[model samples]
Target: MNQWSGVNALCYYLAYILEIYLGFSQSIALILASVAFTQYAVFSWPPYFYIDRIGRRRTVIWSSVGCAACMAIIAGCLLNSSYTTSAVAVAFMFLFLDCFTMGILPVSWSYSAEVQPLRVRNKATAVGVFSHWMSNFVVVMVTPIGLNSIGGNYFWIWAIICASFVPLTYFFGVETSGRSLEQIDQMFFEHPRWLMGVEADCTKVVKQTAEDEEMRHKAYAKYDGFDQKEKHVEVVHHEEAK
Candidate 1:
């Protein structure tokens, strides 16, 4: 999800795109690229507050929609090949950064870690990070060649990839928000379907079971503490009476 989104392509190549493809002056391209990155950094924070509240599945799905639209618009503007369209393309590029930061940027790593079983979580997260960097390398290497050859048409490829994530996520993605690791593990165990949309009931049952178990443990601990306090008080009274 992270690799194919074309974010690295844009990040590594934005100056190149602005100066080479869009015909901006070198200094102007550098400035614009820096500003875009600043926007990327600033926009990354807002999702932190909302991602869990909105839920992972919906966040990624809707963010992909916005990303796809931005990519398509940027592609279209580049294809038009005029000063006015170039300006519009620059605006959409900023918007694209906003969309990516809000959705995939925050959710991907956490979601990957959350979905793994406890035993293999460390290894699994490492593998996922490794895969992400490898894919990043591939995209970064391919992007300049793609731009040189395909021109504006190159971003349409990203647009399609972004659009495809919506359905792919909806069909296969589990709702990880508010679910404990145990609940998630049990959900996969019980359902085991390629399509996870029907796992709601199973997840609820697992969650309820976990809650009951937790309450039982708390109750036991409370009673144990009470008994210890009573024993201490009785020991003090016996000592005083003597």
Candidate 2:
């Protein structure tokens, strides 16, 4: 999802695109790129507060829609050489970063971690990290070539890729918000279908039973010389519980 979103492609080549394709001077291109990143940094904070509230699947799906629209608009704008279109393209570039930072930037890594079982989580996370970098490398390597060879049409590829994520996530992705890892595991175990959205059961949060809570308290009290009143027992719950 992260790799094909064309984020790294834009991040690595924004200034180059501005200077070469948009006819901006070197200084102006650099300044605009810097401002775009500043905007990115500022927008990144909102997801920290809302990822749980809005849930991961919706965030990525909607963010992808925004990114695809921005890419399409930018591509269309670049097809013409007028000053107004150039300005629109630049504005959309910043909007693209806004969408990315709000959704994919924060959620991708955490979601990858959340989906893994505890025993193999480290290994799985390492593999995910490796794949992320490899994808980033591919995007960065081909971006210049695509921009130079295909010109503005290159972004159409990204627009299509971004647009595709919506259905892909909607069909295959599970709702991780407000679910404990154990609950998520149980969900997968119970529903073996590849299309998780069909049943929509995973979206429901399972409350911990009173019997289970009592058993946990009894187990904690069994320890010798420990102050049960002061002992902190960390209970993991789904995002909605917060």
Give RMSD to native, each candidate.
Answer: 6.5, 9.0
Query: How well does candidate 2 match the true structure in TM-score terms?
Result: 0.85
On lDDT, the leading prediction is: 1
Worst 10 residues of 1 by lDDT: 201-210
* Candidate 2 lDDT by residue in tens digits, 6-25: 99899999999998889899
Q: Candidate 1 regions off by >4 Å?
A: 202-242
lDDT of 2: 0.86
Q: Give the clashing residue pairs of candidate 1, or none.
A: none
TM-score: model 1 vs. ground truth: 0.84
lDDT of 1 by residue, 162-227 (tens): 999999887788888767687689878878888886456532222234576698679879999999
Worst 10 residues of 2 by lDDT: 229-238
- State each model's CA lDDT, in order: 0.88, 0.86
